[model samples]
Target: EEHPDNPGARLFLGLTLAQVGDLDGASREYKESARLAPDDPFPHYFHGQALHTLDRLDMAIREYREAVKLAPQDVRMRLNLGSAYYEQGIFESAIAQYREALKLNPGDAYIHYNLGLALADQGRFEPAIAAYKESARLNPTDPLVRYALGVVQETKGRVNEAIGEFEAAAQLAPTMAAAHAKLGWLYYNKNQVPQALEHFEKASRHDPDDAQTLHGLGLAKLASGKKDEGILSLKQAYQKEEREDKKRLIRSVLVKVGALSH
Candidate 1:
């Protein structure tokens, strides 16, 4: 109360309130801070962050825009604004902001990764791959980046490149079920039954209830001449699958294999 007119004091109080999980109180304080220090970008930036955490994205974007206006060259402001846009599925705006951020800080690996995501979402696969490659170059050991790159490569029908990326991702994070699953599917498609089985088993160990993994395991087993085991895996996959079309597909496979009635 003694520092009622002090914007900095209100900002600190907002931070403290946020730490204590009193987001409403923090927001009120942040609002007051911004009002008191209308010319200062920090208050608006902090306010935007608080609103973003609350999932009040439209309001957050307003505050972020204000902050960006006050501090056009602040990469953090641009990045946060870009993130808000991305979460709202405003891909074009997100891409624009991310591009602006990259121009300001070209060497930022995290920004490059985010840019790749936005580009990939827009189906700009070539640019997305370029952005992901830059991010992978900047942060060589990041498994998620490798996984994302692998997914884009697979989408582009570059199976060999996808396999290499998924392999690198799996090596970096052994328990990453998605990487194992991708590797299993890729190897299965190549008729490398043993390798497919190995990866499918690893994927199943990490994500036991994944229907796609179970389906791949079933197919791999069938290809390797384990008819009964393959049929059982197919049953499990049918039971676990949530999609009607996929469940029908599994049922058809079972019926074709004489494991189910026509």
Candidate 2:
């Protein structure tokens, strides 16, 4: 009560509350701090952080915008604002903020990766590929960058290139279930049953609940003449699959194998 007019005191209280995981208390203190010192950007910035942590992206974006207005040259604020916009599906706004952040800190691999994600969300695959490439160049050991590059290549119908990227990603991060699953899928499409089986088994080992991996494993088993095992795997995949198209595909296979009535 004695420090009613003290913005710094309120700000300090907010920080303490945040440190103790009292998000609602921290938020109230931050609001009071901002009210006491409307010109100070720190309160708004901290408020944005709290909101973002709570997954209140709309409110976070608004607070971040206020912080940006108060400190336009702050690169970290721009990045945070861009991330908030990305979370809200405002890809163009995110791109603009990411571009500005890149100009301020060109060597930031995460900024490039985020720019790629925004461009990908807009379906601008060509530029998205370039951004992901730059991010991979800057951060070579990052398996997610390699995986994203693989996905874009696949989307562009460059199956061979996508296979290469997925292979590298799988090698770099052996436990990455998605990379192994992608490799299995590509091999299956190429009619390389043995190779597909190898990757599918690895993928299933990493994520036993993955329907797509189970589907691939079933097909590869059938191709290798393991009819009973293949039927079991297909049944499991059908049970686990939630997507309509995938379920239809699994049904078609079950019918072809005489496991289901036509």
Candidate 3:
């Protein structure tokens, strides 16, 4: 209730709403803050954060860029800008911004994680692994980073190491669907079909609507000699899936199991 025209108070109100996960309210406050003082950068920066939370990636990018222009020396803004680019599928641009931020804050674990994602998108497996390793070193408690590293390790054919990372990730974050899925895949690749099925079941249980987990469960069942049940689950996953890529994943599972029928 500071003066209605106080840009700083409006900015703080916007940021407070953002911290509480009220994206729309935060955006409204930020809009008012921006209008109150167009020269101030905090409103625009937090506005970008609110828009990003709402999945308005393009608008978030524009706002973040404006924030960067207003406060060109703020490395954190550059990092936020990089993440916005990453979410929008601009990997190279994301990397560029992240590295710039890194120049200003070399030890930021989140930057390492974001850099790893950009590198992985480019198929630069070695660099991605290095980046992920650095992030894991810097932030050992973050299960999401561990899970991402495990998935990348699996993609690079390091099955045993991947399994270790996935199991650790699962232990740290029991609710992480991706860790369960990766662990299941790791077990499957090691010829431990029963173990694979157990993990797949866990993954699917945690995220029932995840078609990939369902398909994974189906694959594990098939590999363990339950073809009929496997095919049924695969068929369900195929029908329930929404994205084209996930549909393709279901089809691949079906092919591996030798059918796509009722």
Candidate 4:
């Protein structure tokens, strides 16, 4: 109130409001700050952030574009714009912005990971893998990056490579249910029942409600001759699964095993 004309004060006030979950009030102050200092990019950038959080994505994009135009060299501005584009499923625009961000700061692991995600969405598996590899190289201990790399490898039909990456991710973060679940599926497919059971059990311990883990656990148990346990696990998976096709698969397996009547 004391500094109505001060753009900096308005910007700080906007940030505080946003931090306190007063997004509507924050947006108003951000707009005022931008109006007061049209040449400054921070107000627009922060406004874009607030709009992004509110999921007003198109409006967020507009503000992000304005901020980028005012500060072309700012990597963070480009990254946030890319993420907004990604969320909108505009893969081409997201990839372009991520590439530009990479040019500004090639060493940023997160930027490379974002680029990989955009490429992967477009089914550009080769380039996606390359981007993910660079991200992993830059941040080797990041389990999410390792998990992403494993997913791409799996999609490309490189099961052994996928298993290696998933294993690394699981080792890096023991409670990473997704990685363990992927490992379980891969090992199960390779006829390694014990390994499959081990990983599936680990995944279930971490994420007890995941239907996929339950399904895999059931399959591994069946393969290993644990009839009652396998049927129980399959029943649990069938009950929890939401996808029609997956539920049908579990039902068919149960029918074939004589646990469910035709």
Candidate 5:
């Protein structure tokens, strides 16, 4: 307590508080440290982490940016900044930070995963696929990476490749509903009604509130030409669809089937 504003002591205290989930106290320590040592990035980096823990994304982003500016070669600082931007939904900024970090640590699986996420956030499916594939290759046992790769494949219209990645993700993470749903959608597109139905059902069972899988199930039922069952499934899908794209797809299908007025 001799010098509460001492940057080193404050940094350690802030870190301890952050580790124990006392974000408010951590922020206070970080602020005092930064005030005393504005030129140093340690306080700013710690402040950013504390702010992130408190869900103050905008402030967190600002602090991380300060750390990156002060410590340009510190790969961890850039990575932290990128993660903060991602939380703020600033995809371009996130990608820039991640790319900068990649230049410092090109072989890092975590960095590649971050790059993939940034690309995916901007809907850059092709680059996302490449980044995610690299992440998966670097960390083959990482279920999350496999799941991310599956998503990139799906987004890129590589349905068969997506299926393979999804299957790998499912094998690695049986509980991930998105992978199951993606596989279900791919099977539906391929006209494999039974397999599509099975994956959809699995997806629904894993995450009951997932409207996409339920909607896909409806389409699969229709693909099988069972009018009554298909109509019921479609009705459920229509009732629960929240995404604009899903709703549009449902509308187009309904119009073609004379179920909804175009």
Candidate 6:
């Protein structure tokens, strides 16, 4: 308490406040620490973390840039800076930092996955697919990596490859609603109604209120000659649908089935 100018004491207090969820107090202490010890990167790094937690991403980026400048070899600092840039939708900057981090630790699957995400955000599907494939190779059992790969593959119009990845993801993580839903849609596209119905049912069971899954289930049931069940599923989907376009499609189907008037 006596040495108010002690940067170490301020830094320690900042850490304590941050741990207790007092982000505002933590920011204040961290700022004082940085001011008192301008050459120390720790205070700037911790300050960046607090700003990031508060969603002040631009300020977080500035502090992180300062910290990275002071310690260019610090992998975690580069990773956090990349993450801050990603949050701000500065995909190029995010990619640069992630690439820099990769040079420091090339085998990190999570870093590869994050790089894929940044690349994907910029609509660089081919490179994103490459990054995701590398992530999958590094983390063979990670359902999330498989799922992300499938999404990018689907975007690239590689339906069969996407189906393979989504199927693997669903098998690896049976309760993942999106994986099952994606498999169901892919099956539906292939006119494999039975297969679509199976996955759609699982998807709906996992996330009962998911309108897209319910709609797919309804369509699959209709194609398989289960008109009554299809109608019920369509009604459920309509009730939960939030998008006007989807609601309109549900209404049109209802009208065609004589469940609703023209």
Which residue segments of model 6 deviate by more than 4 Å?
Answer: none
> What digit string (tens of lDDT, one per residue) describes model 1 on residues 1-262?
8678999999999999999989889989989998899999988898899899999999999999999999999999999999999999999999999999999999999999999999999999999999999999999999999999999999999999999999999999999999999999999999899999999999999999999999999999999999999999999999999999999999999999999998
Worst 10 residues of 3 by lDDT: 253-262
CA displacement after TM-score superposition, residue 57 of candidate 1 (Å): 1.0
Query: On residues 1-262, what C-alpha lDDT tens digit does candidate 4 reach at each position?
Result: 9779999999999999999999999999999999999999999999999999999999999999999999999999999999999999999999999999999999999999999999999999999999999999999999999999999999999999999999999999999999999999999999999999999999999999999899999999999999899999999999999999999999999999999998
TM-score of each: 0.97, 0.94, 0.71, 0.96, 0.79, 0.98
Model 5, residue 102: displacement in angstroms? 2.1
* Model 3 clashing residue pairs (backbone): none
lDDT of 4: 0.97
Check candidate 1 and list the clashing pairs. Answer: none
lDDT of 3 by residue, 1-262 (tens): 6658988888888778878888898898898899999988888898998888888999999999999899877998998899999888899989999888888888989889989999999899899999999999999999978888888988888888889899989999998887888788778878899989999988988988877777878888888889998898788888888999988878987876669532
Q: Which candidate's TM-score is highest?
A: 6
Candidate 5 lDDT over residue span 58-119, tens digit each: 99988998998999999998998888888888999999999999899888999999899889
Evaluate all candidate structures by whole-model CA lDDT and list the values in order.
Answer: 0.96, 0.94, 0.87, 0.97, 0.85, 0.95
TM-score order of candidates, top first: 6, 1, 4, 2, 5, 3
- The C-alpha local distance difference test score for the whole of candidate 2 amounts to 0.94
Count clashing residue pairs in model 5.
Answer: 0
Residue 90 deviation, candidate 4, in Å?
1.1
- For candidate 6, report its TM-score: 0.98
Candidate 4 to native Cα RMSD, angstroms: 1.2
Tell me which of candidates 5 and 6 scores higher on lDDT. Answer: 6
